[model samples]
Target chain A: MEERTVCEMCDNPPEDEGYELPLCANCRDELSRCPFPLWVKLISGLVLLLVLIAFVNFPSSLRAAAAFERGNKAKSKGNYPTAILEYERALARFPDSTVTMAPLAAACGWDGDLRKFAYYLEKLDGREIRADLADEIEEILLEFEDLSEMEGDEQ
Target chain B: MIIPGRLIALVTFPGVIVHEIAHQLFCRLCGVAVLDVCYFRFESPAGYVEHEPPRRISQHVLIGIGPFIVNSLLGAFIALPSAVAVLQFEAGTVLDYILVWLGVSIAMHAFPSVADAKSIWQAIWSEGTPTLTRLMVTPVVGLIYLGALGSFLWLDLAYGVVLAVGFPYLLVSLLT
Candidate 1:
């Protein structure tokens, strides 16, 4: 028996039914012509251009979250340098973002970068820390003490 | 494993490339005035082709399918020589064998391309589908691609898996 592939957009057999995940045939035909008046197209084009510029120029909130994820992953893998790199990236992308700062500071503390941690703490707005995160950071710092001692002995 | 990783990387590189090319190709075919292409690579690189998004879903789907169609052919070509070289690898040094394995692995996993993801995301976000339909379609489509590939065994499959996992990270970095 031949294996059948379904249409990706809509969950139907692509061969048996006309494709409609993105659009059916009639809808596709209709969209070919500009739906807006000519003026609307011009205005929307200009607006989109502006939005594009702004999106690029602005500090990215999404990047902050991504950086935090990367940092967490790196920490779990015991890659302190990589974790720091991710945190630094987050800081660069979203200087004023609290979400970036808190985890970044925590990572720095774990890496024994006390001065860096202090810097991030200073920059952080005075929001109360959640109990879970505060405890986690404390544990990371305590663990880092042993890590640094081991490194010191190895040297 | 070494050969597989390299093959996987080789296959993976083209997924992003094909996705962009698909967009550009469809624009030209639709008689739309092509302006320029802005391309983004890895986490840091970003660029775009200078044409408006197509008004029609058919045009969009054509562009979306471009990467899958192109890369699948490319993957086949890559896999053929790689498999041959791999079979002839008895005399090869450790490094030579490693390279071959990497190459083969990457080629095998190099498909169901990310252009499909972008196409799905755009279709969901556009006025093309009703709100309820859009909600239903977007996650379902994304999960299908992602969930299916979670267990893919080949090297090229690994590349696709990495891309699937990493692309969202890239998107978050770029969009936010």
Candidate 2:
């Protein structure tokens, strides 16, 4: 009698194509896709998660931080218009951030846009402002009021 | 000594069925010819899907790990409502417990078998494999082995519990 070889998986004797680690035909078929590469599936899954997050508009603090950084860079370069736009974008993401509001008010003041400066200052009025920025804002508001009075006198 | 593979299979039949179904589903989606499918058997694996190898290595990879993706997601989804009910102190019906069991079973089977890890390694080293493929497959192979080892420590059950309970709890907290 020919010796029967056992399958590694189910321990069934191989009826055909018997060899070392002899898998029965059924077991061999089952093992055909063994050691399936998981990385490909994981990458695809991660891509799906990113797409889902994008669709869901998940709140991302990183986005707010990036916008804040862009605003700061623009402000430091004396580009008040770009700073204002970026600061507004940051504030839109993080609505209640005093850090964002302070920069926005400063940007508006630097741009000599009195109306927007007053708008942002009024928004900041009830909230506690940082000492340095508060001093600058007070001076800018006073200068704005003085200019407005001079224009009224001329009229 | 005879290994109690059949007994284990009987105990976790839902997982076996979902796992095989996931494989078949991926094979169909990948356009691979499904030669055979055993949804359940008295034998060791309990269930399996036999399909022709896909033309692209990527497709092959997809077919192999497809069960993990399908089972985990399906398990989590099915468990959501039951988890919510249980958290709210509602006396869930027998069907709810069954759903929770089914979900956890499916999730527990989400880890690919050791054979799957080997297949992925082979695919990674196969001829004409892209550099990107090698880069991506390396970490996955490591994780697959890790998960396989974790199974010995009941990490698979832990993973299932997280999906069935932790995820639902998180969703509820977020909404409220």
Candidate 3:
């Protein structure tokens, strides 16, 4: 014998098929509403909005990071011009980023752009930087020094 | 070591609320009827979604794991810029801290509850359950139990940190 099915909530004939819960369209809609408290709705809505904002803003940051990566790769490969360009691109997206700035300064120094390198190095003075980067910068500065003018009498 | 779940839920209420929402949303998506739901409360369970048993194993799996997918992605996305700025670039604002907190709070609750594992186990082991499902899903259930056990050691908090903060750092590092 064929059995008849009915809505579990309203006890009416089911309107939608393929549902494990025997509910008509109206009851299904009602259940979907959830009736969560107002604050929960507000908070969840706020979260979704914030996440959307972040997602929207993410591409720029991602591009900046990618550009920074390209810069590092270029610098390592002695492609100083490409590295400088990529670093500039990253700086455009992430302005005043010390990490990017330090690397940019180092790249300029390696490329022998003394004017730009000295400018960046002077700007970085007294700024807290990674020890290794500080050492690299110091070495770059030493490259400009004359050995005879040095006061080291240990020779 | 045996602190109540309610206290933890109260502290991380956002995660609890989102977890319940994820469950309800999946139920709606699967065309299942939700009998009841509590997004958050100062109770033993903290939050819950009562819904009809799904007709398919795939639906059940989705419903059980919905929070893991939603919370992880949301949390990680929410934390990405802030985490990278503060942790990697050493630059951030007050707003970044707030966003990081929210992200960590959400990610902290990504694991499926042990009860969800038990239900899935029952469904998979029941009569007529496909062999493929049994093989594929058992590991998930095991992991859920392990997660439940690890919660005693605050592994959930660590998981949150790794997902929401560490992931973005890893992403940036990989690109470089």
Candidate 4:
């Protein structure tokens, strides 16, 4: 008697040629285009609902990001108070973030808030930063220091 | 000890569906006609997307890795806030837990199956293939095998946790 291998998927006689996986003609065809089950529709609906919930909560989820964006925008326009406020919000969301710390220090220095500038600069000490960004921060610190020195000399 | 693939599929049915949808979406994006898509079912493979042979190696790559990109990004996006609230700050609600589960499940199924690797292998080795594409695809195929093997060892779940929890913390730090 010739040996026959059954289709592991559908339990029918298998075709000699096709995919490496064992399957009958019908099962192979079904593999290509199986009819959708009602359960699939229900599950899809549930997934959609989950996605919708995520979308709804997107703004809340990215609260820190939004604040950070606003901070950059305010800083670009030279609005120091708003910039500091936004950067502070970003920092609260990410306390250990050196990215926020450097920027916050820069904004405080520019705004002439010496105490906060010193505090943040100290906090940012030895924190790893991108070389290019570190250069920019260094330049800003020097300029602010020069201004503060000039004011003290006049006083 | 061998656990049936179908049981895993049934447990993470949502992820399986998303994985198939991701494959089908990539097929559409690559302009390959999808002949069949089994989103989810009580079977050995759970879900699959069958498509016509792609015209280019890039298309083949996109189709093969589509699930990884889609599932990981989507999972991270959905889990960002919830992960922060629940894990980082420890101030999450019931809804946050649900979102965390949903996101992690999607991320967990990001790995491409061994079948996808086999198809990619054929595409790379076939006549008229560029050497660069062949070289590039070999490691990718290796990764698919690794992911398949790792799935058995719960590597997929670990990836899910990273996407759900670690990704959120990273995003928060990158803000601005």
Candidate 5:
């Protein structure tokens, strides 16, 4: 009996027409002159996409964290404008963060932009606020009232 | 032909649904507008995702083989915990058996259909196909053909068993 060699891919015996790489005739034709090109693209593309997703998300998350730290440092230095810009940039990358929003409201209030301060405060409404932050916001509101009274007297 | 397809679909309804969903998910991911999606029907094709053809060959390929990638991975992931239980010879709970069944069903349908293969072939031969892409897809096409042949001899089932049971066992053993 002749020793029949097997196709490496499917583990089936090679057809009468033997080929290199221990492949059967059908596998050779299928591989060299593929009838189903779309599948090749699909499988390869998906694997690439999976790899890309894993690579992309990690660095972007790190960048967002760095931006948040920069915003906090700017806020601490009493540079309200720079802090606002950093906070806005950070929020744009990672939106709906209460941590960023609270400091943003404080920055707006300190910069004497009551309208923007009120907007950020409204966003914080119904969410948990620390006792010290709430007292600071109350002080800002009292300051706004005093400014409103002075403007009324000037008018 | 209709009868056979319907019979197969009926027997493997979960696989059919997962297969169609995989195609639809890829279509959306590739930014192709989905015209229609029949997740499971009594028709010959069983289920289908009709969408606008993708502009690039890479996109077309991704959309075509999406199910094989998604289903196989999902099946293996879902089966891992249950696979551990089985390896430890724990009492076969209802949920464990269900997970194994679901995993096997999903994995068994990981191979793209012949129609899908034909569509991919046509795309490969179409204008502006890169030589590198052509070279890359040859072996994949052969493997797909092999998968089709394996289906006839219960090799697809064997593959599911390997993914759900064998691979998990190997992993658990390595970890221990």
Candidate 6:
């Protein structure tokens, strides 16, 4: 979704602030009316609010966007597992989404899961992969081959 | 609401809760009083935990173990039947729908909050040998969480379902 302010709890990127977990002002005020303990009600309200926002903003078609964002962040942070998780989410939701699949395959290639990279590449037909990403995937394949050779030597 | 739905993020949050519940259960096993537990998210969504601080890594790990146990069991129990029903039925009936819903529900729960993950990561990072022990436990935990994610990926529906289900895990993971 749109990042508005620094998250209230964790002060991360400035883009994610201001807004409460999921609710904008309109929704939060309504939830505040619940009869539960003020604190519990508030938290429950906030969480529920976030859910609503997620649904509205992060629709099926946009899942690719979410995946792209997630993969981008995870790749940058060296969290390959997490990045792949996001890319996988994108793939599942938007199976035909070429925008995300290419990057995701490149990421898989980086992780040495060439089977998946090739799988997605085949899906790409003759479409050109991004120049930079193609190079990156090629580099990874080379490294993976070299590593396997090293393993062979050790054996 | 949308945000709480995010709270239920697949890999990061639901998994974290399973892990935390693991820690909580072990704490109970070891005779520790459980106070409160939370995982964090940011801006519109976050989590918190207010608990009596444990003096030992063992206690910490026990609480961490909570989500792993919960999700693994949940994944096996819910996903199995759902898988069967989905396979057996061509066009879904109400009951099949219910089963599918149940399976998705269980599967959606397959992650940890990054917030909680960070805390555990910190706990592990801060300790040397203790961290190794924590690392050992994490894979077991992640395996179950992965099962939950696998279920969702296999089922593979619309983005809203995945995001509604998966975002919370990421939110929790990333924020923490």
**On residues A50-122, what C-alpha lDDT tens digit does candidate 6 reach at each position?**
4344334233424444465778789878777778888787667556656566677777776767788789878
Fnat per predicted structure, each in turn: 0.08, 0.00, 0.43, 0.08, 0.00, 0.00
Name model 4 segments beyond 4 Å from true.
A1-155, B1-3, B89-91, B172-176
- For residue A38, model 2's alpha carbon misses the true position, in angstroms, by 30
Report the C-alpha lDDT of model 1 over B1-176, residue by residue, as the tens digit: 23443343344543444445555655566743344554344332222344545555555555555545554444433332222212311222343343334333333333434445565577668764667766666665575367335424443465533433343345555653
DockQ of candidate 3 compared with the true complex: 0.29
Candidate 1: interface RMSD equals 20.6
**For candidate 5, lDDT tens digit of each residue in B1-176?**
12354675687676777787788777766655565677778887887877645667777788779989988997786565565443333323466566667678778788887767767777777777898888787666667777877777777767777888865555534432
Which candidate order results from sorting by TM-score in descending order? 3, 4, 2, 5, 6, 1
lDDT of 2 by residue, B8-109 (tens): 568767677778778877876765556677877888667777765455777777877888999899778666556543332233445556666767888888
User: Which window of ten consecutive residues has the lowest lDDT sum in model 6 chain A?
Assistant: A27-36
**Stretches of model 1 off by over 4 angstroms after superposition:** A1-155, B1-15, B38-42, B45-51, B87-119, B128-140, B143-156, B159-176
Supply the global lDDT for candidate 5.
Answer: 0.68
lDDT of 4 by residue, A15-121 (tens): 65423455676665555444456876786677667657755655555686668777878988989899999989877766766766777787887788889988988
* Per-model TM-score on C-alpha atoms: 0.33, 0.51, 0.72, 0.56, 0.50, 0.34
Over B121-165, each residue of candidate 4 has an lDDT whose tens digit, in order, gives 999998889898899889999999999999888899899999888
Candidate 2's C-alpha runs over 4 A off are A1-155, B1-6, B87-90
Name the candidate, 2 or 3, with the larger TM-score value.
Answer: 3
Model with the higher DockQ, candidate 1 or 4: 4
**Cα-based lDDT for every prediction:** 0.50, 0.71, 0.81, 0.77, 0.68, 0.50
The docking category that best describes candidate 1 is incorrect
| Model 3, C-alpha of B4: deviation from truth (Å) | 9.0
Cα displacement (Å) at residue A51, model 4:
5.0
For all the predictions, what are the DockQ values? 0.04, 0.01, 0.29, 0.06, 0.01, 0.02
Better of 2 and 5 by DockQ: 2
- In order, the TM-score of chain B in each prediction is 0.49, 0.88, 0.91, 0.91, 0.87, 0.52
Candidate 3 local lDDT, B48-139, one digit each (tens): 89887777888888899999998888778788767766555555566666777788888989998987888888889988888999999999
For candidate 2 chain B, which ten residues in a row score worst on lDDT? Answer: B84-93
Candidate 2 displacement at residue A119 in angstroms: 58
